[model samples]
Target: MEVGGSPTWSEPNGPPSPDLTSHAELPEKLRPKNIFEIPVWMGEPDRFCGLVVEWNNEPVHVLPFQKGYMIFGRDPAVSNTFVGHPSVSRQHAAIVWSREDRLAYLIDLESENGTYIDDIQIPLNEPVKLLPGHRISFASCFRRYVFIDQYDRVVKELRKSRPTVRVRHILVKHAESGRPSSWRGETITRTRDEARAQIQSYRRQILEKQEDFGRIASEVSDCTSAKRGGDLGPIFPGQNKAAFEEIAFRLNVGEVSEPVETLSGFHIILREG
Candidate 1:
């Protein structure tokens, strides 16, 4: 249910009248039918990456596996993914990430239609480990999910092969006339360690908050591709430099690289494709 960003909850759907202070005090007629709550993404590293909801062959909804309970249901105000179907409850089910065990469990939120794993109904409120290709369903609502983690093994299962990824980069030169990574009209006139520190900060923000890589690349990237959000297009193995290929083949689709050193400069990579 949680998505990482600027630590702000998304209220995509709000109450009919913004003046209503008390949800309980609001009159029935003025009540908003769909109030969705964007789950607060946890900053914990090494947690499960996310779940791809592919129910009924519908468009996928990515539910990031962040540090807290991921709540799902029809109530947009409370649930991260609000199922528009009639069968879905406002607060139907939740997926909890156990830090100690490094496992994710699907617990029924006392949903009316019940929650299912692989077509079998699970006991209420009990935790169940969702395996790869395991379908997490809410009753007969037709919503389904396939889970994937940050590790390359899990990513291979998700894509059915090692992918040829597209990547974008913001390169900051460290030598003479070194320039800033972004479009701030600044130059990298600092020491190598200082440049790395600055670039690494950008990488940290993207990973911790799930910031949009393309947007950051657009604003700060030093390369000409910054105009296109540093898009390098589809890159196969060995097509890029040794270090770049090392990261490209190993990184997950949405992963960001720490500031990397090359002959030319330090670069921050985003696996766009």
Candidate 2:
């Protein structure tokens, strides 16, 4: 099945499942009451924006708001995004974009603990104008939500239809690596050139000698993923280091990469998706 714009094959030899679509109708009471309260699903030009959950000023999760209402709380049934904190309400808050003002607003749903913007609680059901960089929180929760006005929306739009890749890699860590410990709990002592040579040799084994890539990766790769045959899972855009992502995203499915250097070490990647 096509989930989140990607096809899923349930069986190893079976055809990919059919794409799924949402056909449920929105209830009238949930619809906007006035022209100024227009939802994003109504389809207006230039209305893409989002929120990012941050920790220590760095983004940890992205909450994209591109539809009617971006509801967030502990309840999956009512919330578009789920925040699993004990203090959070069932339906805590929502962010709504207005075409009339070309702006977004945060509305608290009379939550038990209350929704906070910049550490101050907002009035229940009132729309508070949101600005980029404003920190948001749920019921005095530890997680801080930072608002980004544009947030690379243009680049994301350009690549929205681009397919993401799943990859496995063999890493060779050198003495100078950011983390010089191997998956087997051994400290690395090889030089940078030595690591590069080792990675290149592994690539040669897969391409020329037709050696099993996963077996080699499981045996010698320095990454913790080596335990699972170096599987790094599906790589979405902006999910990994720039150097590694660049090489991984460019290779065709089933293709193996040359030695690619990153802060962690040298890697030989095999694209699987």
Candidate 3:
């Protein structure tokens, strides 16, 4: 970034932080002015463009600026916003555009499996500076990435498919309890708000022990489908409610849905296909 011909970066609200550039010499007239403030438009699409993190032999993720923060993770229920990928932590990492300074920061949310920027594991809760093009990795060593600031280039190169997936779920009923119950023994009556909170909690538990969904569902799910290990079969249109269909269709293969509520009750859905 440049301000008044001077190299620029986000500062900690003090003196202009040291120049991040160590490249070729610049003309005196093009030299940076001290303590320059960045405008709100700095992160706008017309200004800094956006990023595409290429991994798995292709551009797997494209995040546009001015779209608020871009959250990347594996748990669909935990990080209910933005892109979701397999094997990545539910609350993995985020690219935040600082409201205070019009600059971007990548902050890790302290996931079970860590997030990496250029092979260095990001520490929990710390904000790392994001340059124009940097790499980020989630959950594995082979999954390398190249984050580019060019927007149109990535969109043109994007070759992703939106294939549907098969699914199953563990329905932990709250209608009879008047509040959500996870382990099937709570008799205490609670409100809808409490039910929602309990459902979110259950979603977290389900995500962490994903492989045990069927076994756990058979032991815990209130629905009769639990007898068949919670299998819902191929989701056909009109078989389920519109809300459930909307979220079910968006799930990546092998990803699980967060606690979802409907006339039936709170649900923990898994995309088997």
Candidate 4:
């Protein structure tokens, strides 16, 4: 007999099992919000301008924000056109336009080590947006001065013209011993150190395998509930690790992330909704 109208399989006597794979077919709901136009100082306002790594004036690497922030490389010859560096932090810098606040901020992601704002380091993971007159430091073999001009007039104009959007998300985790942890209200961390620390802690837990992240979860989880098998439900944007949140929000729903390490433990995230 045909199964579900397909001739290749036998029909079930009762209702057929729900298709688990259907979850995979669901469309992702999250969307990328429009930020703003790239500032003139970062690139050619006409074209996407930034510090780009080039070989003999031919573009090889494009620094996200290179105009406002300066970089020093070991070789001055190759470094002038393209911010030369051994790593992302040592070679990228920019003055960014913030979509949320409609403000122009400077970020120097290109440095031998990295740069910081208000004492918080930039670009170990993500880029920092600079504020007007904010101090920026650059490190190569030695320290150097970086400048961010006061452009409040432009910022004020942008803020008056652009509209802002409010995005919300939920984070889900398996409960322990049938008791799930209460949802912590949303938090927005302003400092880079605070964000980095949170991401680092989450990574440590995952590396240790203390939380039942499924698969190996049965073997190492401290939570009794997941002993039934770690099955965390739906997770929304901004719910977990900052690093994870940074990337996760970019993904469509029903996509499973490669194992992500967090302070709680390793996680195999499956976005439900």
Candidate 4 TM-score versus the reference: 0.27
Error of 4 at 222 (Å): 28
Worst 10 residues of 4 by lDDT: 1-10
TM-score of each: 0.41, 0.43, 0.35, 0.27
Top candidate by lDDT: 2
Which tens-of-lDDT digit does each residue in 100-163 have in candidate 1? 3344567787777989888899877555766656777786666577766654454446455445
What is residue 181's positional error in candidate 1, in angstroms?
A: 56
- RMSDs, each prediction? 17.3, 20.2, 19.5, 23.8
lDDT of 3: 0.55
- Count residue pairs with overlapping backbones in model 2: 0
Would you list the rank order by lDDT, best first?
A: 2, 1, 3, 4
Q: Candidate 4: what lDDT?
A: 0.36
> Which candidate leads the pack in TM-score?
2
**What ranges in model 1 sit over 4 Å off?**
1-45, 58-61, 150-273
- TM-score ranking, high to low: 2, 1, 3, 4
Worst 10 residues of 2 by lDDT: 1-10
Whose lDDT is higher: candidate 2's or candidate 4's?
2
What is the lDDT, from 0 to 100, of the residue 191 in candidate 1? 71
Residue-wise C-alpha lDDT for candidate 4, range 114-183, written one tens digit per residue: 6655445666323355443344443431222233333455445645664322222222233211112322
